[model samples]
Target: MADSTSQPPRKLAPPRFIPPALSETAYPALKTGSGFVSRNVTVRAWGGDEKLSDTQRVQASGLAGCISGTTGGLMRGPRNILPGAFVFTLGGILGQLGLNKYLRHQAQQPAPGPQEPLTERILSSKWSPFSRLSDEKYIEIMEEKILRAEADIALIDDRISDLRLKIQERDQRASTDINK
Candidate 1:
């Protein structure tokens, strides 16, 4: 009998539609002329090289429609609502533009290769705004600042005590002159 374990496992067929999560590859073979039309038809039609599945395209279309409808509704309101409407429309447009830019940037980034430890990834990521100083270094910096502040407070207290002493001496001299 043939040994099943000795034979290499067969490869599975590629899915008809690549999942949206997996479509962020360097080169994706997208469907060229899918007749499916929707609100985001313009964007989808022009995205010749980006592989977007039918569901994703539809979702994008729905989102675009919602934004357009909300903006249009706001624009048609009374004069009192004009300012609010303008702000709403402007914010919506800016948000959509920002989202597009972010998506494009993310797509351009290379996919993760071998898995690294979570701590290592977080420490190395450029997105973090915090300094990556060692614990000891951070403690030393804080201690130096605290010591400097304490010294300044001590100097101020000493100056205040000297002023109080001078005021007392002046009062005693005035009293002696008045008694004389």
Candidate 2:
């Protein structure tokens, strides 16, 4: 007894391939295959069957900083888009607190590690960032940044006052409608 059975071909899903990392091997300097041509070549191209360049390694290292985000075929490097990347975050914060603008820029580009606390960065002598300024001129610029900061704070306060007025009007309208 022969049991006739036929299974239709299963629709094959399209393949999605992720590129594997390149191999790691150092290509040493070796003489070319030309029997006695007295020529010294100190450099050679590093493509195909050779090692990756230092730049490629550095870029790969930067990507490792964001490994958790690369699962499901997505690529979002951590350093590329940090959490608090708002350009003027420090400015807005100091403005809210009525701080000086000189302090804001100074705080932003502090002298220490590229991203360190303001006080620490300023005090680290080894990371001094004074090259961009002259002592006499720096004093004058500081005054200007502080004055601008004060003006910005005043403007924000005025805006807040106007918002308060609008809120009061909306409240009054709601009260009148409830009474009716």
Candidate 3:
């Protein structure tokens, strides 16, 4: 048998002599938006730079609202133009403001505690259905299951034995016929 305690073989080192042009072309050093120097280039976020003032963000949100409102107004007949634009624009602004507030609040709040293991959580929770059962009751249920499984296995074994006997009889009959 092979020795399980033996150390694994070391990985081979890459060749030192990479062409300068190939190296520069393949792995050019690029600065990320977060100001980290990395070998791979990253795509910029939508609307170019990350530094947007509150006014700019609000304006962009308002512009989006206007576009959505105009689209909605167009969808509803020309008769409902004024009403659609007014309602949709107001709704969009309110929705955007609510979303921004929610995001800010979420950001301000402390992160949640480390999660409990599923089994531990289930056993500990008072609301869990299984939590109502005592350890002794659980053990009793498991024991009943084991007994049922053993009974099933016994039945399967008996059936297998019967099948083996039938197979043996079939072989014997076939052999006798061949001899004749």
Candidate 4:
């Protein structure tokens, strides 16, 4: 019997936001504008590449976003400036959300191990419709699969035998009762 003290397997939590990789880029225009502003305005404003911190980056991005958004809005219509301010704010929030989700995903991912030369060679093989495994490795994989199939067949046979035994016992009892 299983131990009563053993805990149930813990389930992983559903992610709070969709992973950045799966989702569409949130506000492409904002991103392009922010980048342009960062490259032009922020660089000039802050005296160019002093190795900014994360806070600084966000601040610069916000400033750049505001400048670009305001300019775009102003160019579109004089009346749009007020609405553009609100949109700029919303865009900043959404950009932050996207960045945060991306960072979390990066943090959660396991660091990949260095690839073995043989494995790398096999993966890089140019041969179409054919595996690049060595003859021994191919044989080993097939043997492993055959062993697994044999084990599954053994378990199924055992179940069938058990069921047949139960049926025979039931039949014998019924026959005996009828005779009696």
Candidate topping TM-score:
3
Residue 161 Cα positional deviation in candidate 1, in Å, after optimal superposition:
1.4
Give the higher-lDDT candidate: 3 or 4: 4
Candidates 1 and 3 compared by lDDT, better number: 3
**lDDT tens digits, residues 1-180, model 1?**
888779777898544234546555511222111112333475556473267644454445444444454433433344424454345445545565666677779889999789988877787799966646889999999999999999999999999999999999999999999999
Alpha-carbon error at 32 in model 4, in Å? 4.0
Identify the runs in model 3 with alpha carbons over 4 angstroms from their true place.
1-50, 117-123, 132-180
Q: List the residue pairs that clash in candidate 4.
A: none
Order of all candidates by TM-score, from best down to worst? 3, 4, 1, 2
**Candidate 1 C-alpha error for residue 162, in Å:** 1.2
Q: How many backbone clashes can be found in candidate 4?
A: 0
Higher-scoring candidate on lDDT, 2 or 3 = 3
Candidate number that wins on TM-score, 2 or 4: 4
Reference-based lDDT, each prediction: 0.58, 0.44, 0.59, 0.69
Which 10 successive residues of model 2 have the least lDDT summed? Answer: 26-35
- TM-score per prediction, in order, is 0.34, 0.28, 0.43, 0.40
Give me the runs in candidate 4 sitting further than 4 Å from their true place: 1-35, 43-50, 104-110, 115-130, 133-180
Q: Write the per-residue lDDT of candidate 4 for residues 66-113, one digit (tens) a residue.
A: 766665555445676667756775676468557867887997999888
Candidate closest to the true structure, highest lDDT: 4
Worst 10 residues of 3 by lDDT: 31-40
Clashing pairs in 1: none
lDDT of 4: 0.69
lDDT per residue (tens digit) for residues 1-180 in model 2: 544696667998444233333211211111111101111111122342135444433333233322212221122233423432232233233333343445457779847745867666566656776434569899999999999999999999999999999999999999999999
Estimate the lDDT of model 2: 0.44
